[model samples]
Every structure is written in C-alpha cells, then in structure tokens.
Target: MRPTLLAVSHGTSDATGASAIAELVALVDRALPDVDVQAAFVDVQQPDAADAVPAIEGPVVIVPLLLSSGFHVHHDLHGIAAKKTDAVVADPLGPDPRLADVLAERLAAVPGDGQPAASTSPVILAVAGSRDPRSLTDAEGMAHLLEQRLGRPIELAYLAARKPDLRTTLTAHPDAPIATYLLARGFFFDLATRLAPGRALTLPLLDNGPVPSALVDLIVDRYEAAEANVI
Candidate 1:
C-alpha cells in the first residue's frame, strides 16, 4: 500500500493563513491521487502531528511545510516521527529555486510603482526570522536565489529576532519594495505590510487558493523522498 503523506506546518491562527494551508494540502492531494495526503500543524491549530499520525494505519511520511529546519522541524516534528517506526520526516519546503520563481512571479504581478525601470526599485526579502543560524542561512539562500532571478540585489530583513528588522531596512531603502518570504498571511506578513505600507508587495505562500503548481510539486518531491526511506 502507498504510504500516507502527512504535510505538517507551523499552524497559524489567522483565518486566511489557515485557508491557504488547507488549499496547499488539497493541491498536493490532487497531485498524488494514489497517495493519501494529510495536514497537521506544530502549533496554534488542531490535529497536530501527534494527533494526526496515530490514525494512519500504514507507513507515513511527515513533510514539513516550513521554510527552514528550525525548532518545529527539529523538535516538534522529529518528536512525532520518533514515536512511529514506519514514519520518516522530510526537510522543509524552501531554499529551493522554484520558490524564487514564485517570488519573481509575485513581484511582476504587482502593479509597478510607475518607476522608469525595474532596476530602480530595490527589493527587500522579508522573512519571519529565526535565532537558529541554519534557519538564517536558509533565508539567505532564498534571498540569493531571488536575487539571481530578479537580476538585482535583494536585502534580507526579519520580522523578529534578527538584525536588519523590516523597519530599519525600509528606512534604509525608502523606495524599495518588500517581497515577503512567507508561506502564508500571519502576524509577520501583516507586520511586514504595515512596516512598508504602500511599498510592500506580498506573496501568498499557499493561501492564494488553487495552490501554485510549483509548490505542489515541491511538496510531492519531499514526500516521495521520505517515502523512499520508509522501510
């Protein structure tokens, strides 16, 4: 029998954020009809990993819908996987070039500020920062990927717990646009928008409904990779 793909995320209380996550899971379910897909969260939502995993009868793969291998991935999800012999955990869904493509697409979709040239409008890749160095590294990797795609430099700013906070970054580049490095709408995304008001161009991670094909593909890839080791 095919193993179930347990797509876990750092849950949010924001209704829009919740809806976005559900849409993402639905997209993954559609992509892999043969394999069962389930959604769980690490916090702030019901049916967390622990509650969701026990119900599955056969092998399971826990794919974190997170951008980095931070506390939730290492401790929360790992703790859940440890209790199940047939389960394996997959890495977070970011630091991928495809995500950069999504960022670029979001940037392009936003109405231009009537700037003479794209090069004139700088970008700040705003993320919910982590104290973990590895997490920071992953965010930096994403910034680099986005920079390559946009053919310009992108500054990395955090919503919390890191240097170069959003306000500071915005102050530094008054006219720059903020490309949110977030998966869905939440407190951080809201804060980013408030920080830059008119200049912040937000991208809905999974919440845009009808989930992006690229994101679905990435989630499936992670599930398949973990499933391969489910023995």
Candidate 2:
C-alpha cells in the first residue's frame, strides 16, 4: 500500500501562519511526487488531526515541520495523532545536511550575492530558540556546516528564551558588517513577533530552491524508512 502523508503543524489563530502551513502541503506534493498529501493542525484550526483518518486507506506518515523537537513536536503531535498512533512521525528538520546547504544558499543569495564586501566582518546565524538539548546541540552543529559551506565562521543567535542571545551572536563575530538569519517557515524573521524589525537586509525563509530540495530529500528518506515498516 502506498503510504499517505499527513503533515501536522502547530496551527495558529492567525490566518497568515495557518496559510503557511497549508502551503507546506503543496511543498510536500512537489517533493513526494504523486503521493496523497494532507494537512492538519494541532490547535486553533479546522480539519484537525481526526480529519486525516479518512484521507488514507493505507499506512500514514505524520511529519512535523517544526524547527525544534519541543513540546509540540514531541508531545502535542503525538497526543493528537493518538488514534492514528500507529503512524510514523519523522524527526524535525534540524542540523540536517540539507539545512547546511540551505543556510549557505541563503547567505550566498544575499542582496550582494555574498561578495566579500557584503560581509565587512563575520556572520551571525539567528535561529528560533529552544530549551531542548537536541535543538541547542543542533544549533551548535551549524557552526561546522556554515564553516565548510560558507568558508567563513558563523555564530548562532537565539531569538527567544535561550542562551547565546543575539548579543552573544553579535559578539562572536565582533566586527561583522552584515548579519543574516537562516530559518524555516517564516519570512526570514517572524514579522508577527517583536523579534525582528523590518530590516531591509532580511529576506524570506528557506524558500523554493536548494533548501527545499534538500528538505524534500530528508523528508522522503524518513518516509522511505517508514514505508518499509508500513507506517
């Protein structure tokens, strides 16, 4: 049986956030190529987890497009999918090889195209914070990736409730003239939050490009493994 895909997101009360989650379904369609794809929300939205039950006649793969393996990724997604508990849940996309490529691409595609002049000093990698050790470790792992791909030292910055705050990140590369954020799911930075002001240098998240391609491969690998087990 062809495994079905149900991507559950931490749904938001805001329409825009909800729309982005919906867009992810289309993204998976492009990645998986001809597989049935469904979308669900863990909260504050319709077509909830129960809605995915009838969408698949075969095994199902539950993917969480969240950044960290926090409460939502670890517990909430599981709780909602309890009825379909047999489904296989893929790990969150963090510190994956593909993400490294995405970060490099984001930096290279900067308005100045990564010209030496664009970076007057070093680079700062601003990320959404997490209390999870896995996420923090993943953030630390980014240093190796950024170093190899970018051929420059990159420092990690926390957007909220975590260590190595933006100040620490800024301090890491004491004289960097240009700072950029490598993130998923939002427009470079979440405009809805005070975390980011409208910086002209800021660009969109890992959009349709090498990043998406890498993201898809990682997701598909997870699916292939799950499919072998009929999950």
The model with the greatest lDDT is 1
Provide TM-scores for the models: 0.94, 0.75
Model 2 — which ten-residue stretch has the worst lDDT? Answer: 191-200
Would you give me the overall lDDT of model 2?
0.60
- In terms of TM-score, which candidate is strongest? 1
> Per-residue lDDT tens digits of candidate 2, residues 56-119?
6766877776655766766766664566645667676666666777666666655544566544
Off by over 4 Å in 2: 12-21, 30-34, 43-45, 50-58, 81-85, 112-120, 171-188, 191-202, 207-211
Tell me how far candidate 2 lies from the true structure as C-alpha RMSD in angstroms: 3.9
- lDDT of candidate 1? 0.85
For residue 75, model 2's alpha carbon misses the true position, in angstroms, by 1.2
Candidate 2 displacement at residue 178 in angstroms:
7.0
- Look at candidate 1 and tell me the lDDT of residue 175: 70
- Ten residues in sequence with the least summed lDDT for candidate 1: 200-209
